[model samples]
Target: MPQWSDYTNGQRIKILRGREITQPQLAERCGLSVVTIQKAEQDKVLSLTTLLRIAGALGVDTSVILGQQAPRRAMSMDDRAMLRELSRAVHDSWVGLLPRTVAAPSADELRAAVDACWARYWEGHYAEAGAIVAPLLEAATAHRHEQPHDRQATAWGLISDAHRLAAYVANLMGARDLAYAAIGHAQEAAESAADNMRHALVTSGRAWVYLRDSRLKAALDLAEKSAVDIEPRFSRATPGELVAYGSHVNFAAVVAARLEKKERAKEFLSQSHAAGARLGEEIAAHGTRWGPVSATTQAVGVNVGLGRIGKALALADDIKDVSALSPAAQNRYSMDLALAQAHARQWDASLDTLEETLTKAPEWSRHQVLPGVIVEKVGRASTARLRRVSKLLGVSNPVTGGFDTATEKSAL
Candidate 1:
C-alpha cells in the first residue's frame, strides 16, 4: 500500500495528470513553458510560484498536490453541483434564457437579495454564496426586464452586481472562462445602468479576473486606468467613491508588486492608504470592501509578496482590528502572517499560526494554496508537528523531490 508521502512530487503530478493531459497540454493549462512543466514532473526545480500556479490550473487543493490527503479535503469553492448551477445561471441570463415566464422582485427586494449574497461571499461562505447567486442572477435578470422605464436602470445595476458576485466566486474556483464571461456581462450591465462609479468598479472587478489569469500587464493597465478615471477630489469625495478609488489603486499595487515594480506598487499603495484614511473604518459599497483596515491589510500582503518579510511583520503588528474584517480577509492576513514567520525561519511560530487559522476556518483554508507553501518552507519544524500540520492541511512535503524553498517568492 503506497501512502501519498511515499511518492515523490513528480510521481504525484504524473499520477494526478493521468492520461487526460499531455505534458505540453498541462504546460499550456498552467501558462508555463513545456520545459517548465517537464522540470516540475521531474522534480528538478519546483518553486512555490510554479506549484501554486500548477495547483490553480488543475483546480486542486495545494496541500493535496503537495502530499497525501488521508482523504482529500475538497474545498476552494469546488462544489461541482453548485458551480454547474451557477454556470447555467450566468450563461442563461446572458443570452436571455429563463423560466418561460418569470416574476421579478421589487427593486428594494432585488438589491437586498444581492447584498445578502455578497455578505455571504465575504464571510468565506463561497459555496453558500454560489448557491444563492444562481437563483439571484436569474431573478435579477427578470427584474431588469420587468421594471418600468424609470426603474429599469436600477434593476440593471442590481444585475451587474449579481454577475460581479458570480465572477468573483467563479474566479476563486479556478473557473477562468466562466469568470471572464460573468464579468463581461457585469460590465455590460453596468454600462446599461449608466452609473459612472458602478462602471468603474466593474472595471476593477475585471482587472481582478485578469490578475488571477496571469495577465499581469493587462490587469495593471485596467486597474490604473480605472483609478485615474475616478480619482476623486479628496475632501469632497463620498465614501463610495473613495472605496472605489482605493480598491482600484490597491489592485494596481497588487499587480505592480507581482510584476516586481517596487516603486510603482508603493506609490499606488500610498494612494490607497490616503483613500482609506479619508474613508475611515472598513465599509462595503457596490459589493466590494475597502477602507483603512482593508488598505492596511492589503499592504501586509503587498509587502509579503515583495519579500519584505520584516516590513510585513511590522505591518502585521499595526493591524489591531483584524477581527473586524470579513472571514476571507482575516484568513488572508493569517496566511501572510504565517508566511512571514516561515520566511523568518520561525518554523514553529508559522505552523502555530497556520494551525490556529485552519482550525478556525477549515472550509476556506481547504481551497487555498498558501498553507501548503508555508508548511513546505518551514523546513526546520519537528517531524511530529510537521506531520500534524500536513494531515490537517492534507498536504505532503515535496522537499525530497528537489523543491526550491529559496524560490518561494511571488504572486500567491
Candidate 2:
C-alpha cells in the first residue's frame, strides 16, 4: 500500500531486488560491475545507459526502478498480440504456408494499403497499423509467387514494405528478436525485387534494429554506408531519393551521437539537412518521414545524446510548429525537450512538457524509457507539484503513502 514516491531510487532498487537478486547477480545480468550496482543501490549517480540495462535485466520498465510506478511488463497486451501475429506470419512465409493462389490486389491498391499502414503507424495507431500489415504481407507474398515476372517485381517490393512495417512495430515495442526476423523477411523481399533503393531501405531498417539493440557502431556503419549507396547527385535527385538518403543520414547522426562522435554526428546531420533543403517539403519514403523539419528534429536529439543540452534546447526553439511533425515524431521531440529541461533543473517545465506529451500519446509514452528517466531526475527534489505529476503518471504520492486501490489507476 506504500506510495511510489515514498522511496528513493536506492530504496526502490533494494525493494525490487529483494532477496531474489544479489548485487553480483544483477551486475552480471546487467553487464555492469558489482561496484556499480552497489553504488546505484546506495543512491549514487549512474549513467542512463547503465540504468536502462539494469531495468532491462530486471524484466521491468524503468519506471519501477525510478519509483514512478510498480514493476510491470514493458509491452502492452496489444503489442504482445501484434508480435505474436507477426511471428506467425514470418513463420508461415518461411514454411510456405501462405495461400498460394489468393487474388492479389492491384498494384495501385497494394501501394495505397502500404501507404495507409505507414500513416497509421506514424499517427501512433501502432496496433491498428499492425493489423493491416499482417494481411497485406500474406497477400503480397502470394502475389510475389503467382504473378508473371514483370508484375512479380512489384509484388516483391510490396512484400518488402509490409515486412519493413512489421519490423518497425516490433522494434518500437522492444521485441528485438521479432524485429530481427521481420527485417530478414524484408531483406529477402528486397533482394528478390532487385531494386537498389529497396535494398538500401532495408539496410536502413537493419540499422534501426541494431540501434534498438545497442549495436551502436554497427548501426552507424550500416547507416552511413546505406546513405552513401543511395545518395543521388543532389541536382538530379528525385524527391524520393532525397528522402531515402536523408533518412539514413539522420539515423547515422543518431548513432554517432550515441557513440560520442560529436563532429561526425554533426556532419551527418548537415548532410541530412542539405538533402532536406533540396527536397523542400516533408516526405515519407520507405516508411520514414524525412525533410528539413525531420532533420532539425533529429538534430535536437543528437545534440542531447552528445550532452549538448543547451544546443538541443536552442534547436528545439526553432521548431515553431510541432504540428508539422507526425504524432510519433512530435512525441519523440517532446521527450527530448523534457529531458533537456530536467537536466537544466527546470523541473516544472519538464513536467509540463511530459504531461502534455503523455496526454496526447499515452500508449506510445508507455513504451518509452525517457519519461521514467526524467521523472527520476525530477524526483531528486521533492515538491507538491511533483507529487501531482507523479500521481498523474500513476505513481502514488509519498506524503499520503497509499491510495485506494480502486481509485489508483494510471492515466495512460
Candidate 3:
C-alpha cells in the first residue's frame, strides 16, 4: 500500500499549496478562526468540523483530507443502514464544525458530493476525484462491519460507486490487472448490498472488462442479463436512475458492435435507444443533473457499426466537450471516434485518437479493459492497412505508424 508518507513533506506541502489559496484566506472563506486555520497548516490537530471546513475552503471534499484507501469487505443489510448513518454522521460532524456555522445537509447535499466526484472522473482527473469520495466509502465500509444486515444493500450501493471510480482510474493508467482487481472488490461490495442499480453498474463494468479482453460473447451475455434485470426495475426508479442504466446498456451495445455481431449489436442498440427515450422523458419531467443521452451521440456509433462512415462523421460535430461526460461516456466517445475513422479507412487518424484516449483517461481499473482492447485492435488493424496501402501505392517509406495532429484534434 502506498502511504502519504511516501511523498516527502516538501512535496506534500507543495500539493497543498497548489490548491491556489493561503491558509488564512481559506479560513476566511470558510468562516473559520485564523488560529484554527493556522493550526491545521502548522500540522496541529483540530476538530473534525474545523478540518472539514478547511477542506471545503480549499475546494476539496472532506474525504480528501481523510486517509482512506480502497474498498474492503462486503456488508449485510443492517451494515448498509449503518453506513448510511455514518455518511450522515460525517457530514453532520463537518457541518457542526463549520466555523461558527450550523445546518444539517439535505439529501441533495449528500448526492451532490458523489456527483462532483463523478464529474471530476469524467474530465480525466482520477486521483483528485478518487480522493473526493474516499472518506464516504471508508466510513460506510467501516460502519457496515460494525452493523447488522438490515441496510447492507444501500450501504454497499454507495461504496460500490467509489470503487467504480477507483476502477476507472486504474483502467486509464493501463493497469489491466489492477483494474480487474478493483472491479472485483467493487462487485463484491455491490452484490452484498443487492441494490439493482448498483448491480447494473457493476455488471456492466464487468462486461466491459470482458469486451476489453476480446471476450465479446461473455461481454454480450453479461450485458443481456443486466438489461433484462434492469428493465422491470426501471419503473420503480427515478429518471436519473433509469438514465444510468441506459448508459450501461449503450456501453454494452458498443461492445457487441465491435464483435461484428450485427443482429445482436442492433438488438442491443434498440434496447439502449429505447431506454434512453424513456429516461429522457423522465429527465424532462424532473430535471436531471445532465440532460438525456444525446440521440445524435448514440447514433454515431450505430452508424459506424452499419458502415455508414460518412454519416457517422457528419454527426461527429454534435458531440460537444467530450471531456464533460463521465469516464465511461468519454471512453465511448473515443471508441466512436476510432470506429468512424476505421470505417472511413483513415487508419492514422483512428490510431491517433486511440492514443489520445489512453493518454487522457483516468487510472481506474474498471475503465481499463475496454479501452485497451479497442486500442489494441485498432492499432493492429491500422498497421495492417498501412502496410497494404503502402505496398499498393509503391511508396518507399509510407510512415509506418505514429500519432499526428489529426488524432489530437479529435481527442480534444
- The candidate scoring highest on lDDT is 1
lDDT of 3: 0.54
Q: Against the true structure, whose TM-score is highest?
A: 1
Against the hidden reference, what TM-scores do the models get? 0.78, 0.77, 0.54
Cα lDDT of model 2 by residue, 223-318, tens digit: 888888898899998888898899888888888888889899889889999998898789887777788888888888778788899999999888
Candidate 1 lDDT: 0.80
TM-score of 3: 0.54
lDDT, candidate 2, at 16: 72
Using TM-score as the yardstick, the better of models 2 and 3 is 2
lDDT preference between candidates 2 and 3, better one: 2
Candidate 2 segments exceeding 4 Å error: 1-74, 99-102, 149-151, 391-412
Ranking of predictions according to TM-score? 1, 2, 3
User: Model 1 RMSD to the real structure?
Assistant: 10.2
Q: After superposition, how far is residue 324 of candidate 1 from its true place, in Å?
A: 1.9
Model 1 CA lDDT for position 229 = 84
RMSD of each: 10.2, 12.1, 13.0
